[model samples]
Target chain A: MTGSPRPARLMDGTALARRLTDETTAAATALHRRTGTTPCLATVLVGEDPASVTYVRMKRNRCAQAGIRSRHLALPAATSTARLVDAIGELSADPDVHGILLQHPVGPHLDERAAFEAIAPAKDVDGVTTHSFAAMGFGLPGFVSCTPGGIMRLLDEYRVELSGKHAVVVGRSAILGKPAGLLLLGRDATVTYCHSRTRDLPSLLREADVLVAAVGKPDFIRGEHLKPGAVVIDAGYNPGNTGDVHFASARERAGLITPVPGGVGPMTIAVLLAQTVRAATRQLGLD
Target chain B: MTGSPRPARLMDGTALARRLTDETTAAATALHRRTGTTPCLATVLVGEDPASVTYVRMKRNRCAQAGIRSRHLALPAATSTARLVDAIGELSADPDVHGILLQHPVGPHLDERAAFEAIAPAKDVDGVTTHSFAAMGFGLPGFVSCTPGGIMRLLDEYRVELSGKHAVVVGRSAILGKPAGLLLLGRDATVTYCHSRTRDLPSLLREADVLVAAVGKPDFIRGEHLKPGAVVIDAGYNPGNTGDVHFASARERAGLITPVPGGVGPMTIAVLLAQTVRAATRQLGLD
Candidate 1:
């Protein structure tokens, strides 16, 4: 291992998100001017998860900035699956709502999948539906989940070639890890997904030319596990704004590393807004 | 390694499939008696791929024996995407055709994804549609792809516990490799997908508790790569009925191994018939 300190090139999501939001705002304005109706996103949150509430608020604020209308539905934590499904169904049936974003980890007892499924595929701008996941996995055209979509966009923006690259995704959660791996595969990268119980995670991580750490463990991936000149994307959003990677050690070894605070975090809302405008455009047959 | 020769336990897919077909036959009979409509599967094929033809024939024979109706759609090799889409759309819209199976590798030029997408999710018996793929990946209730479904059935038939196992799937093809890994992930297995450009493929194979060799290369996986006592499933069927895993060497090292000709092949047809009945039952609301 080189003891030399290599300056890691940062992937600035905040700047890229600003650019994306500008494009989305223009698209939303165009749609509104042509159709006399603004693109609308319905944000549904169950219970009072501080994180969920904060995420929805951020999304709504971004929506307003992008010239998209925001419709908020805050349900009680103890809401039943049937009632939640009914509400989502109603929103799906509403013509004004072009997109729907159901905040993740709805509650302890609610069936999150059933609730997400209720959102019509056309209006599933958050890309949490099974339809979206399948489309992503199969390399079919569909809205991608915000975080993973953000990661891919960053890779594309940096001109990091994905074809035949060994991408080791250190997480396997449905929305994050699995979808991330599938998206990498869609770009022709040979993706290997590692999870909590995966034996020899370090060994697999070392083989990656592109390593995506989404396992939510702060500083779980150290410098030694990184392949020399590997592009590292830390998608973990832990408390205190910590990342999954040990950045100090990783930056010394990595060719590229995304910082915790300004990296992948900002891109989520940007993609959400971008997809909202897309959904509106497609619904109105503008595209 | 133990020098003693252990007699290979046969993975009797034919017998297991027969048993499953018998059970399905009874279910179909019951449904027919109650609803007066036999479950039907529409098999669509483009061009005359000899292997695919044989596969479809086998499925139809099995369906007939199980008292299920078969609807066949055969298009010429030069069939346009629009015509093929139209044919599939017709089948998808047919109320009598409860399930749809579009035999794969339609043509090099044809957009297979578009063709597969034409089948409605409700009648996607073979589970090739994006909706079924997402459903499987998310651990939701949906039809599974026949080959992967058959592989799971074979594992269950032999009492192979998947949870917490290190499963190395050596392929990433849309239907087989990709879905196989997702199915394993759904079962809580730590799944790693290796493909054509995957570096150190053999080394990854050496670490697997369960190894699924789905890459089409004949005898690609050698015995040296086999982890001792690994449950090996060779889903590859090459010319002359060869498998991707070198069975002679793998058999020496593996605790259990599925023979290429008999292991996963029969299970595919069995699963198709079973899922056809399932799709029929679900669509008819008879279950």
Candidate 2:
């Protein structure tokens, strides 16, 4: 109430997501009619991490709504790296499975990279593999990480002029922060990556035309750190269902902003379902 | 006489390269004594382009100097993509060959990415494959693109603190400019990539704390565009042996600069040789 008179335009992820899913549903139905093949996604989740379980359940629900098939593999917490690789390898070899999604933070004991490599590049719809990452980094055609891909789709929906703009990404995780920066770089944005090791985060944040807060800390990016009229993308999903940005304060100064529950969250599953359809089409030689 | 009274100190590529090669030579010797297998590098050139021939020859010469064996395969310019891929596939399967280097810009017709993919990931010493690129992008354990690898080495050797520093890269070639920016981002630099479509290049150049001029156009980056006391890296090797930077004027303002002939040129081959030794040791179980 104490800030700018004109509040920022909210980037409505829910409405945009509904439109995206309508298109995806039509595509899936058409593909099923022509090829007599339902787009199938194989999801592998290690351990019953409550958060991961809920995430996977949400994805499964989204897939069902989109007319895509979901096959879930629930592995125990004590599974070895070799066993996880074998499980993923089996899915990668299955012609019926068009896409593979492996839940992350799968126990500290497993070698994540090795397990990711086991999934065929073609079946990497979740975009967690290094092959997918390399393709994304090089701006080549490949699956992209779901959350980052969602962020890009949202930006595109808003008709954001990314070129020549300074995009400050406040994280460096391989999946979210890194790929997001690379994707922005591919689109001609001057991308700056700041991590825990980065000095003077607020000073750098103030220079951004587009600020992406991927650091998974609630209310980490304050309104004062942002440049006035900056486009704010909150990718962080921390405890208490809050995002990385302090929404109330940030909304006053931002030109555009995404709400926590209704923003980046919905678009992620939308991308996953869409990519799965693409994977099925390509694999079935129908595209 | 027309420049600043104190020119920027040259980051001596020749001397640093010598130290690197000396270390590689010792490692090669130790590996040979342990496994009785000398490191072997396979150089493939697909055309009679004078530049390609010279580059392959230079790489082979350096391999010999380090006591590493060299194998050369010269193919006709008219060779089909399939034939080129087959040739590379054979080398990738050859147990005696520790590393592979393919001379780029084979022709306008052939698919470069396909040929690069033919090289086994483990033996991609030149780091041209998508696998290598992904590894470099993800900050994983794998070989980097030679020139970019060398640039990182030079930066590390000079103890250039990249964290939170603005690094402006003036190109976006798949192998050179793109990888260079990713490497700087990996080291926590705020990276900006400028290309032909980039608007207001001069304005962006002024903000750079570390500027990499990989644009092939000589004198493209004028002295007035550079920031005072900036670290300037000239990676261009254009016609007339001139760099992308206008050395005469830019050196006056820069605190550290790499000259055209003796700068980034020598470090490329040095990294290639070093990676070949690593490949040999890893493949031979001598690590």
Candidate 3:
């Protein structure tokens, strides 16, 4: 029989997210009690895409459970970029809406960056704007892009030593990969930003002490490409609940790994709700 | 001489900057003729730091030679953040000022970021603002920090292949290293950001196809740590007219290298002057 390697330690993002949400709930209650104003998260969905609809509804339900008010606007798929921007702008201008979440992939035709920019920086709970990006890049105090922000929380919860470690980010998407790399770099990790244009993926992957699998292709990275004992954070969630990393193989090679369904998904919601409360606290001058 | 290594091909930033300035001169002249408006650069210096004074004077002289107007504002060393911000804001609002340049290291007492943020995005020729950094990170249209912008031009002039190349940026200063890395990433180069906390410097150095030395330490990176035939662009300008790269040793190992005095320094001023013309063109509706 071949020698068996120790199975990777699983990062329990679900448990951490639940604890985080509980803390957020307490904060939300205290905030409401002090101001007598509910922290409202207004989610704007530009299209009727089934996936986006489910995501928005799930977030709204989570918000309700956390004592935060939820407001939903579902627009038709054919909504113009200008109209979508206008709708988000209106929500941004509304004093009652403490935070705004615009479901991404608004449509292929829509200029998503332009629409995201329309969300006021103060109300950008999802943290998808250039302002937030700038804040993350500058290492300044401001909102972070939600998915990556959750990734950081998971890393912290797991006690992964980031400083002086080599973190290879395997995507450069605006909301996820880019911000994740910046946040990691800000924490003093030597960060390599690899994307579709990167040459020799295996070479970089093999050297990554912490590999952020965020390319969005299901099971794109295999164990063969990974360094043994690498901390693997898979940010991919597909229709079948699969991840960007080959989970079974990755578990064999990685020292730590995050499961697809239970890992990053819940953390995203937790960070969003937390940021909403923080935004409310700031906007209401209760900070 | 049997084992003599081939000397590196020098990257002549001086010639490139001169050629760029000539082009800028023509554009500035054309703009003045068409709109009867001279491209004006307002140089705001807080405290008479000697090096800053010399740098500002050099820029003002370049503006004069290139047919662009320059306005100098010298604030006292005791200037508060609010006063400095207000002064920059006034120049930003002034239609006569086509661009604004805030001489950096205003003093130890000031918040440089807050002061840099005061420069309006439209007239930010120096590109030290968060807006410019975001633009670079997003690959969006906006001016870049002068030194990094110059670095790109030199890279382009030398026809260095950025796509898929591994670029190692050896600093993370807000104005220089961070923007430089972002620009390199936007060009499709796999970028690794190494800072003071980076461990095993030689390992990362050996993999760098293009090395950007911007750590502001004289001879911080040496030849022995370098990959043979790497293109080295040193951005450090020390008091003795030296650079971050140990030149003699770097030339022995590098395929191409920038000479200290002529390398990144002149290119920076050239980019600044060129951006001044652009800001003028856009503001005057000559674009």
Candidate 4:
């Protein structure tokens, strides 16, 4: 297979996610016994987008398995921004709800940020609010964006050394790429952000010791562009069940890589559940 | 002179600052005439570190010159974080106070972030709060750190094209380097942050089309490290009237450069005055 040099080891995100789910289950049980209040996550969805609906359902089912309760709010797609804000505000004020997750892409007309900001900082389990973002940037105590947080966990589990390494993040979306890069920077890896406006992508990619493919385009990063033995993280998901990086050729050059299907997807929900328990424990004064 | 290339065009921050000050003065006068209330800035300083005191005085003097009122609060070095927080909270609540500037390097014992959070985001004209930082990162409406804001203004006056250009930030201190890099990123520049842990400094610097030298150490960057014809912004302030970049050598290679003393220094105060008037106008519903 094209002079494969041991075909770079795949990071096992699915296995790690299972381990995390078990741990979260125990923590949720302990929290429930101590406080007599099941950790509740308020999940809000403003539209009937199939992807968002399925994703929210997946999270709620996981919550049930972990002994966490779900308070689901399904608003009409035509809801006003003000009404959506009010709905989230009610969830924020409810003491029983330990965490909040507002499914994103709440329609183009709605003010997503205004709605996200309505989630109380303490209950922002999805880490979508400005408060959580600032806390992440400042290295303060707060919940992190689930996907980026999971990517970091995967790197840690694989024992990849981040310090002094050149990490090139190939996207700058608020939740995924920007936070991922900042989190890497916090670990002392020299960080660079290359976007659509980047002049020379191949040149920049070759300098990266760790490359995070976060641009939502299938096969955006190829083996030719990769630095030898680079640690590649594919954080992008497309409709055809592929990642931003071309898997087959990338494995030839990469020392460590994440597969499209099992790499970043499961870890995200696992992190969300774990953070939900932590949020509940903190709110219940048991942390 | 070893092949003296035409010296880099010096960015005249002093002249730009003067023009900005004239604009700020006129704005302040208009706000006062319409609302019958002068724009007021509250300057809070902890510990009488001679340099801190001098810097506060400089800002206060500039505020007065711009037709802005100053309320100075100099806390004793021994004051606890609680006391500092309480003092800042009072000013945040004061209706007459249009803006707040808390000098950085507030003693080692106190929680600086906690104290910063006490100031309401509305009056955070100095932009040290988490809200302001998030706003800056999200490319939303908010105040910005004075020095970084001034650096942006200087770049604008010179008609520097930032889109798709590589911007290298030499440091990552909370107030200066971090904000400056984020600001550049918002302007669509491909940004890189290189700090003490960076492995190859010269390699990264050579890629920069817009280089921001913000490391506090003098002579940290040299001419050989710069990309020939790069826009060099030396935002460092050293004790002996020098900046982080080696001026004589850098001028030979740089296409445009800011001098240590007259560049980046005056423009900071100008932005502060301008933001104060803006805060007042917005608060008074005149915006």
Top model number, lDDT: 3
The residue-level lDDT of candidate 1 at B186 comes to: 82
Q: Give the fraction of native contacts in model 3.
A: 0.88
CA lDDT of every candidate:
0.88, 0.89, 0.93, 0.92
Q: lDDT (0-100) at residue B144 of candidate 3?
A: 98
Superposed Cα RMSD, model 2: 2.5
Docking outcome class, model 4: high
After the best TM-score superposition of candidate 4, give how far the Cα of residue A91 lies from its true spot, in angstroms: 0.3
DockQ of each candidate relative to the true complex: 0.58, 0.55, 0.88, 0.88
Q: What share of the true interface contacts does candidate 4 keep?
A: 0.84
lDDT of 1 by residue, A1-287 (tens): 65235667888989999999999999999888899999999999999989889888988998999999999999999999999999999999998999999998888799888999999999888788888998888777889988999999999989999887889998888788889999998787877777877776787888889999999989999888888889999999999899999998988888888999888989888999999999999988887
Listed in order, each prediction's TM-score against the native is 0.92, 0.94, 0.98, 0.98
Q: Using TM-score, give the best candidate's number.
A: 4
Predicted candidate 2 versus true structure: per-residue lDDT over A121-165, tens digit per residue: 999998899888888887889999988999999999999899988
- The TM-score each candidate achieves on chain A is 0.98, 0.98, 0.97, 0.98
Pairs with steric clashes in candidate 2: none
How many backbone clashes does every candidate have?
Answer: 0, 0, 0, 0
lDDT of 2 at A150: 93
Q: What stretches of model 4 exceed 4 Å from their correct place?
A: A1-4, B1-4
* Residues A165-196 of candidate 4: C-alpha lDDT, one tens digit per residue: 99999998888888888889899999999999
- Number of clashes found in candidate 1: 0
Candidate 2 local lDDT, residue A160: 88
Distance from true position, residue A55, model 3, in Å? 0.8
| 3 versus 4: better lDDT goes to | 3
Residue by residue across B100-195, what tens digits does model 4's lDDT show? 998988999999999999989999988888898888888989999889999999999999999999999999877788888889999999999999
